[model samples]
Target: MIETIVLDIGETITRDDRYWASWADWLSVPRHTLSALVGAVVARGLDNAEALRLMRPGIDVAAEYRAREAAGRGEYLDDSDLHEDVRPALAALRAAGARVVIAGNQTVRAGELLRGLGLPADLVVTSGEWGVAKPHPEFFQRVLEVAQAPARATVYVGDHPANDVFPARAAGLRVAHLRRGPWGHLWAGDPEVVAAADWCIDSLMELRTIVGG
Candidate 1:
């Protein structure tokens, strides 16, 4: 009965408004330009990393992100970066006897950041630790192994339809699409994608109704 709840880190649990603005400031690009870049990538169904590389070929995106985290500057979200609804929703799930965890394509430092934020997660796993990314069978297999949950009894919540919704569903897990961030807002117009999700919610709080308690 929905014993395990898997959540995406970026956009799903953490809001990115301030984060993106910070990135724009760091790169000396106008906020609108950054937004346009993201939009262009999403529209072309291209990876964001590819878009960044095309925009500035020599820059190392991963290293830049690491530097930002180290310097305490630009788009690095901490405990304060969490959306208001995250805590209460997660707390409710835990109280309902559910094992909630963070599963996403984050860096090695993600576990420390999530823990420091005091997020209500039993575990925080990343692509780094699992040696694979989302939409891959191995990634979901790792998640299932860690949660020790059968597909039918688990629900995955995330903002991206491709990385979060489709893949988790393909793994036989119920999916909840939280329409808040770039991917969510951009893909919201696709009726087929929207309807495919077991639950399309505007807030994390709605998870309570979808899962239980």
Candidate 2:
């Protein structure tokens, strides 16, 4: 039985439409380059400090691009409300006696976003604070340790294929892919990630069935 559920914050729990565009603009790289950089860092087992040292220059360019885009549109990016079903789904999981937490790459600002949404997570793991990002083993390891959860007993639910599904699977946690909505397009075309999932669902509500909570 799954005793705990760990979620990724950005796209999984909260629905922010501008995230990708903002990120792409912020880092001055195409969306695919951000994906590739994440993969490269994880593949090389580079820690946050080192990865930043190598990628920050390029990332700065991206960030500036994003800033300019935001200014042009008179739009400032921020986290959106929790998915309609998130609170109810999480409450149900809690009622069923499972612990819930969030694991993602976030900064202090992001933590505030969770609080504003009223998400029922018992723990919050941020790569921004951890100095590492997902798809890296350490990111999951630290979160698991913080949650005091055994890998086999915990299930992680997220949106990204490499950052969310694959590494969580490698860490020995069962994975649920949140496969719909904006980010849904990212997964639909990727054969490797689609094939790797233990379970795939279009919404967080579907998790209740898989883990029997």
Candidate 3:
């Protein structure tokens, strides 16, 4: 039985359109240009933040983040940013006696924003809070700890193959590759992603069937 469900934030629980657009505005770059650069890095398996550095060589990305906030535009995700299926799906999972956790590689301010949204979850945490990011073994270890259930009985769902499918599966957690984000839509047909994910789903609503009532 899937007693716990852990989900990634960006492009999993939410759409990433606003995120990329905001960054483009912050950096004074064209939206399409920033988006294309992000895809390039993602395709090359480099960190997405490399897109920002690529836009402004030697730019202090972290400092820029603070500046953006001080200028009244930092990390922001509102009700509209959440995927339509998020609240319903999470609520159903909890009603089925499953623990729902929202975990992802997001900033501390992003964590505060997420918690402020009050999504139906047992816990909403970020890598900034944990000091460990995905594709790292320690991150999955912390996932298991938050789950408080055996890895085999927990499911970790996300859009990124390298960060979500492989490592989560390797860590003994059942994996669900969600096909809603760019990384997901782009890599959905990749052989390794297909092999690593125990379940490949197109929407969070499908999760109700996976865990079952």
Q: How many residue pairs clash in each candidate?
A: 0, 6, 0
In angstroms, what RMSD does candidate 3 have relative to the true structure?
Answer: 1.1
> Between the candidate structures 1 and 2, which one is better when assessed by TM-score?
1
How well does model 2 score by local distance difference test?
0.69
> Which of candidates 2 and 3 reaches a greater TM-score?
3
lDDT-superior candidate, 2 or 3: 3
Q: Could you give the candidate ranking by lDDT, starting with the highest? A: 3, 1, 2
Worst 10 residues of 2 by lDDT: 73-82
The collision pairs in model 2 are 25-66, 26-62, 26-63, 27-62, 27-63, 28-62
Candidate 1: tens digits of C-alpha lDDT, residues 1-213: 778888998888877667667777777788888878877887777776665676677989879887887888834457678999999999988888889988888766765667677788798878877779987888888878877789888888888878888888888888888888878887876786777688888998888776673
- Summarize candidate 2's per-residue lDDT along 1-213 as a digit string, tens digits: 788888887767766546544555554667666555544654554532333345566545436545665676423324344677788888888878788888787665566556655567677657767888888898888868865768877888887776788899888888888875534545655677777777787778777786684
In model 3, the Cα lDDT at residue 16 comes to 87
Whole-model lDDT, model 3: 0.93
lDDT scores in order = 0.80, 0.69, 0.93
lDDT of 3 by residue, 1-213 (tens): 889999999999988899999999988899999999999998888888899889999999889988999999988889999999999999998988889999999989899999999999999999999999998999999999999999999999999988899999999999999998778988999999998898999999888888983
> Which candidate, 1 or 3, would have the higher TM-score against the true structure?
3
